[model samples]
Target: MKEVVFQASLDGNCLFLNPAWETITGYSVAESQGRQLLDFVREDDRPCIQTYLEQVKTGKQSSDHPVIRLSHKMGSFRFVEIFVWQTLNKHQQVNGLSGTLIDITDRRQAEAALRESEERFRQIADNMEEMFWIRDLRERKFLYINSAYEAFSGLSPQPLFSDENAFLDFVFEPDRDTVLRVFQEVEQSLSYQFRARHRDGSWRWLRVRAFSIQEGGSPSRRIGISADITSILEREQILEVSLKKEQELNALKSQFIATASHEFKTPLTAISSSVELVRYYLNREPQTPFTAVLTKHLNAISDRTTGLDELIMDTLTLSKLDEGKIQVCFQEVDLVALVEQVIVANFTNREDSRQVAVSVLGDPVWVTIDVKLMSHVLTNLLSNAFKFSSTNPGLVIEFSEHAVRLVVTDQGIGIPEKDRAYLFGKFFRASNVHQIKGTGLGLAICKEYVELMQGYLGVDSTEGIGTMFTITFEK
Candidate 1:
């Protein structure tokens, strides 16, 4: 019913028209009956219709099918396909034409819309900076590649359509095998970061990501984008070189510190010995005022020389630790005995030794620890406790089946809460302890030693109240 059936004389006069003619062109069947069929055709297309009809009338073509624009009653044209054949009389001679006119306006408009959409897509793809491509994986052919590919690869995109592996030929030799493997094994998605030779004879870094597109019952396609990452990689290389240079400078600075400390230690030792000799001789006749003054200055010099010597020793020890020259030798030692020995060795002769108390709580704790490192840790902690607190400094040893803990407590000016996080950092001294004499390296060295023995050294402190330092080791 959508098509109109009609008969017209061979001279092009309309003899009969169907009711569907009104539906197709907004013209009544009676009004269109007597008019020529050319009256309903667009003026520009009438010549084409005339030529086709002439050919059919002269027997040059048996039947004619021509798509032409027909004028509608509303001042617009509609596309229609005409299928006409000659009608024969009883004498077997052509007399009239019979045809069906089907409205094809919708199909024509759809085709036009498709062309416009394809144009828009092409424009967008061609303008991108990154290379975009589409390949029919099933057909082993490249379907689409943007102009950026030609710009980046310095080659025509034509050969790629026929030879899918042409780009692989330009891939840097070191990365070619990896790229090939990735392509062969790819399933849903793939990503590759590699270097490839560019048009300028330079290797360029590219980061490519590809995804498989499989539509219902259609051949699979691969759509991917490749971006130039050469600039980013260059920046990273520069940063790596800068970092290496900085590390080398730090190594040189450490060497200088080690050398200087060793050179100063010998003179400091001699100064301390000379001061002791002067003091020993002056003590025989030291009742006079001048001799008393001389003794006081000598004692001051001796004390300073001893402090200098201690500083040099601490510096040398830290340097060795930094260079990884100190090796830990672990031996099973009694915790209680070790604590007592460190206390007697470091604090027994001092006046504050009386304030130090030792307690063994559970059992005789034994731990595998480096003897020298453990001794050093115990000495530092106990010395700090006695120096900071006015009352008793408690050293408690607790033991269990799986763990051993040595807790050192002091009721002194505790570290500030804000400074506790950085307490163990090299040369980091709490603000509250600025007036106290310390080299600030003792805790840092202690922590390193404790960790080398596979133990943990932790601290808890409250400003103006107390501090507790704990060293824990697993059996």
Candidate 2:
């Protein structure tokens, strides 16, 4: 039998014991008989057994089912429950006490482990920075809430148990509707960001995420976490304001540059015209040494004026590009024809012994590009090529079914490795080309123009050896 029955006198001495007593305590029935039942109980729990026996002796008739520890013959202990009843003789007077013992060690041990696990969970949740909660939707009650909620809402968490909306009352007025809608519409999981009023009446941002507990295809509970995000939102707001201010400052700077470049053009034009008139008058009697010196100085002034004018024009173009004033008009142009036109117009009067060799891999390659911009790009590239190289330069035009490439290769004083990274920046001159007469805006302008036509401009160069500039476009 799983249960052991025993009979003891009112004084608590055992008179009879079932055979199962041997299985329970590892002691034979004969060894267990005539011994006090309290002898088998743990020292601390024996008093409980004694009280139970006293109660049964007073005609209590039933045991209180007190749990007590029983010692085994091997010196180990087991938890057991005691069930007692009073025996009555023919005269109806209580004569003996009878009871049953049932082993409950496994049940008691399981309950202990479960209590320990719950304690650990509570410790972790209470100390977390985020608010953790469990709500029973069917019962309309909050089953669990950690202490962090009190810190977040600035109110005691106790009131939240009775009022489901107590915590939501602190949500920012504008966000409360949305928060409620989300709660009503959420099926399985939820996530949202909202603002709430803290205890000090200051607003704070919070992000919440939740999962629903389902029962029979419907939600019956929700478990969720909410975290404070006020600092993160503040940082994001600051960054947005900074970016907007920077953009406005850049626009104002571009406008100022365009205005200044325009203001310089009138004076430069007057200087060029006066130099031409003076040259016209001096050429009529330019035979003496004095007159020849006058003529030379006039030519120098004219050249310098022209250089200044080119610089102003480049500056204006850059400002327009920054202000989004330039318009792009892509059209089908013959690449071979455009190359020939640029070479004839720009490099024809070069006094250097070096020449430009045009190599046409496929004749008359056609591409879609802005004619004016592409011409300017080609002119700038070829001008740089001829100006930098003392040896012959080469321009190759190659085209296939889907793409076209223009390569301008020159054996010039190539750019330094350190300067290549900033080559396309405005007014950036190479470290090795300080003596070269350049405003440093030509390549920058060329790059912007090329990109406007949906093309790419790239260069490969080695210092003092050679440089190659490639422009590629989709055909």
The root-mean-square deviation over C-alpha atoms between each candidate and the true structure, in angstroms, is: 10.7, 8.5
Q: Local distance difference test, per candidate?
A: 0.87, 0.87
**Candidate 2 C-alpha error for residue 412, in Å:** 0.9
TM-score of every candidate relative to the true structure: 0.60, 0.64
Against the correct fold, how does model 1 do in TM-score?
0.60
List runs of model 2 lying over 4 Å from the truth: 1-164, 187-192, 198-201, 207-229, 362-365, 400-402
Deviation in angstroms for 446 in model 2?
1.9
lDDT of 2 by residue, 249-288 (tens): 9888887877777788878888888998888888888499
Q: How big is the RMSD of model 1?
A: 10.7
- Candidate 1: tens digits of C-alpha lDDT, residues 1-475: 7788999999899998888889889999888988999999998899989988888788786444789988889988789999888899999999999888999999999999999999998999999999999988887788999999889878898888899888897799989889878865537788889898888889999999998887785538888899999999899999999989977886886888877887887788788889888888898873898998998999889878776777777777787788788899989898788777787787776754465788887878568999999999988898898778788789889887888999999999999999999999877889998767777889999999999999999999999999999999887
Highest TM-score: give the candidate number: 2
Single out the weakest 10-residue window by summed lDDT for candidate 2.
55-64
